[model samples]
Target: MTIGAGGGSRSNSRSSRTNKYSTSKLRNSQHGSGAAGGGSALGGQPLNGPSMGPGKGDIKHRFEIIRKLGSGTYGKVSLAYDHKNEREVAVKLIKKSAIENKQDLVRIRREIRIMSALKHPNIIQIFEVFENRDKIILVMEYASGGELYDYVSTYGSLPEPEARRIFRQITSAVLYCHK
Candidate 1:
């Protein structure tokens, strides 16, 4: 998907909201989370609907899930605390099916490689990659502030000077990448 205005407005809107449909309705619906089927396009079991929180799942062993941050075709993301480090991290759980095919595997590996190599202030850090029977969890730096899109959306277009500052930062980051 093309990254729009920085925060993935369209895709995130559908994935982030918890009130799209009631929990029971989501569980019962065809695209519901509990449907006994192959799985969702992104690899999540199903829309299991709005959850109070992550249940007692196997993930607890590795990271303590703080809250559900977002979800996508791939899987859900949670603000989790790394028990080992005593710090918060964003865990992206991509289902096996999402990266099961050979092509996807290659892409995933390439993305991981690129992320591992990059070190810039503007970029998020990838801490680790964890795999399980049905999922791939990406441990990433947790950025406390909401995405840039939220700022623009809330305040309308940014002031010219403010936009210029952001542009300079992005340019510097690109230059660093070229180095």
Candidate 2:
């Protein structure tokens, strides 16, 4: 999830170009701090365009929280089950209060906009974004194998073949972003 958005063993920046999603009500909202909490605005259009999570419920209704996957400065990720998809997903939850200012919020939303536009196989896919009064939740493709750095750290270096495979995946994602 966020590992691709500057949260992993290797950090990289996405392009500066504007994405169509940036103009959506969710991204352009004057105050989506979600500080008070409750219900999702879901922007002007419904999330995922009709086929989406509920518009008036806690994120748990659609994604059952499994366990904590990881945590970063801005948010925490939990492994969750997508009831609708009948599969696992990584739920990234960011509290609007955790954000210091509007600038940081803009950067966060920009990353979301960029990530939403991506469809590369090697990259994580963002399925839906749920915004309540205080929290912004993102349901993303689950990487059951976990973070590459965690594997390398626990196993003390990957075998050549495994390392190569991981390298290829990283390079493919990087190249996709470059394009």
Candidate 3:
């Protein structure tokens, strides 16, 4: 998957309306509200299709984990191939234990809700979110651009033109989100 539109053109007014509805739908979804409490994400089952068994079985059945992409405070992201979609996707693996409390869960859910709703060239498209007994799995559009910190660290500094190009892309994405 690429960092591109989810493929449609909507008036700004209508787009915001749909985005609001979509976020609400995601936040209130009972099936996805497991993980944090004593329940399972996807209810310990595969959400998008048939389950392989239990635990990591659902993930194994659906996506082929290719390699590690990166890691954050909660989990690591991996490049995986979605068997159902026939495409590569980035899988964000966040352990249920990693969520410190209800607030963290809320923040995560908010991020997921927003991500699932956004359709932009610079934002990765979230495909599906699920969980095993131990971890929450987020499937998303695969973009292989390395982290900005890593790029800067390796090269020290970018040429003025290169810096401007990166800056423009970042601002445009942020502005899109703001709108």
- Tell me, by lDDT, which candidate is best: 2
Alpha carbon lDDT of each predicted model: 0.52, 0.59, 0.57
Candidate 2 structure quality by residue, lDDT tens digits, 94-143: 87789999999888877887888888767777877766556677777776
Q: 1-179, model 3: which lDDT tens digit per residue?
A: 22222321111111222222322112213323322323323435444422333455344445555567777898777765555555666777787688889899778777777777878766666767775557767777776555567666777988998677667767877899999
Clash count for candidate 3 is 0
Q: Which candidate would rank higher by TM-score, 1 or 3? A: 3
Off by over 4 Å in 3: 1-58
Give the TM-score of each candidate: 0.62, 0.69, 0.66
Candidate 3 to native Cα RMSD, angstroms: 12.2
Clashing pairs in 1: 33-46, 33-47, 33-48, 42-73
How are the candidates ranked when ordered by lDDT, highest leading?
2, 3, 1
Off by over 4 Å in 2: 1-58
Give residue 91's lDDT in candidate 2 (0 to 100): 70
Q: Which residue segments of model 1 deviate by more than 4 Å?
A: 1-59
**On residues 124-170, what C-alpha lDDT tens digit does candidate 1 reach at each position?**
66766644456656767776554666666788987898777667666
What is candidate 3's TM-score against the reference?
0.66
